[model samples]
Target: MARVLTAKGAATRRRILEGAAELLRRNGTAGVSLELICQTTGSSKSQLFHYFPDGRAELFCAIARFEADRVISDQQPHIEDLSTAESWRAWRAAVIARYVEIGRYCPVNALVVELSRTGPEAEGIVLDMQSRWHTLMTQAVGRLQAAGGGCRHVEPEAAASVVLAAVQGGASIYQATGDFVHLERALDGVLSYVGVA
Candidate 1:
């Protein structure tokens, strides 16, 4: 069974995770080490093992979850309110702006690539995040259809899936080329296909 942490213990664990995440974002997964995490978080080796008994692998999985959450949370109010044409446009802009701000360095993608070959747990975390994101977008597309704003004939789930795929592809292209045009064009093309643009 998992140990039940007191509030203070929980806070300490969160601090370690946040610090590690920052380190990973700045230095990449291969560059981050347990000692560095400890120094950054001001926690001891015992505390690190106390929280992550399985060592670096376990700690990395935790960071993967954190970065996954960041991917969705960073999109904010626009991602959650994607029901209308206006809302969809705003969400698209938010996504573009976020990628532009991050440039070629995506922390979550880095984690995914680093940890995916290690075990199923890391892969599952990323897949779960993607699934949840797709579900949200599917719901939003359904809302647009109900409001008679999007194409009535298009399947919301399929459309959302395509949108997610397009965005992922665009992000990969952006990361490779240092250009946002591909991302913007992909988003605009998907929205137009759904009759939202």
Candidate 2:
């Protein structure tokens, strides 16, 4: 059975994860050691082990989940309400602004790239994140269609998938080239297809 943690214990664990995520974002995962995490978080080795008995692998998986949550949480309010053309535009702007601010330091993508080679857990984390994002976007598209903002014939799920793909592709190119043109164009094209442009 899993160990139950007190409120204080849970807070400590969250601190460690947040600290580790900051380190990963700033320096990448190449030189991130348990000692580095301890030093960064001002946490003892025992405390780290108390929360993550399986060590770095387990800790990294937790970090992956944290980053994944951030990916969705960052696009709040706007993503939450996509029933109007204005909301869709706001969401598009929010998405672009977010990537522009984060630049090449995508915590979730970085963690996935580092841990995915080791096993399937990392992949699962990414898949779950993607699935949730797709679902939300699908619902948003459906709302837009119901509101007469989008084409009636365009299926919500399929349109959402394409939009998600476009975002991913745009982010990839943005990271590689330090340019937001691809992301901007992709979003514009996809929104136009759905008649939101």
Candidate 3:
């Protein structure tokens, strides 16, 4: 069973996670050290160990969850509401802006890389995040379909999965090349494939 933290303890833990996330973003995952996280968070080594008993592995898992939440939350309002064309456009713009804003600083990728040290644990974390992400897209497509925006013949679930995959692929390319064309093309391809072209 997980240990229950007091209110102050929870806050401190959250602060640690946030600090670790920022460090991972500024420096690569391999570049982030426990001493660095503790220094930034103003927490002692004992405190860090108190929260993450498994040392760096526990801290890395927390960071992965943090980045995954960031990915979804950063696309908020648009990701949650897809009942209108405006929402769809808003979501598209939000996605584009997020990638552009991040440039080469992709926290998710960094977390993934660090998590690989733990093998399946890291992979499972990524898979769960992607599943949740795809589910959100599926709901958005369903909303569009209900609003008479999507095509009559396309499968919302399949289309959403494809769109999510395309976005991930595009994001990887964008992170490497600092080019938005691939991302735009991927989004356009998804729409075209769904008969929205």
Q: Per-model C-alpha lDDT, please?
A: 0.83, 0.82, 0.79
Q: How many backbone overlaps does candidate 1 show?
A: 0
Candidate number of the best lDDT: 1
The residue pairs found clashing in candidate 3 are none
State the number of backbone clashes in model 2. Answer: 0
Stretches of candidate 2 above 4 Å error?
1-8, 26-28
lDDT of 3 by residue, 1-197 (tens): 98999999999999999888788876776788999999999999999999999888888877787888887787897888876666776777788888777676675566555554555676677778878888998888888888888576778789888977777778778777888899889987876665545
Give candidate 3 misplaced runs (Cα > 4 Å).
Answer: 1-8, 26-28, 111-117, 195-197
lDDT of 2 at 2: 73
Off by over 4 Å in 1: 1-8, 25-28, 40-42, 101-103
Please provide TM-scores, in order, for all candidate models, with all chains considered together: 0.83, 0.85, 0.81
RMSD in order of candidates = 2.5, 2.3, 2.6
In candidate 1, what are the lDDT values of residues 16-109, reduced to their tens digit? 9989877876677678899999999999999999999998889988988887887778778877777788888888898888887877866556
Q: Which candidate, 1 or 2, has the higher lDDT?
A: 1
lDDT of 1 at 53: 93
Weakest 10 consecutive residues of candidate 3 by summed lDDT: 110-119
Worst 10 residues of 2 by lDDT: 110-119
Candidate 3 local distance difference test against the native: 0.79
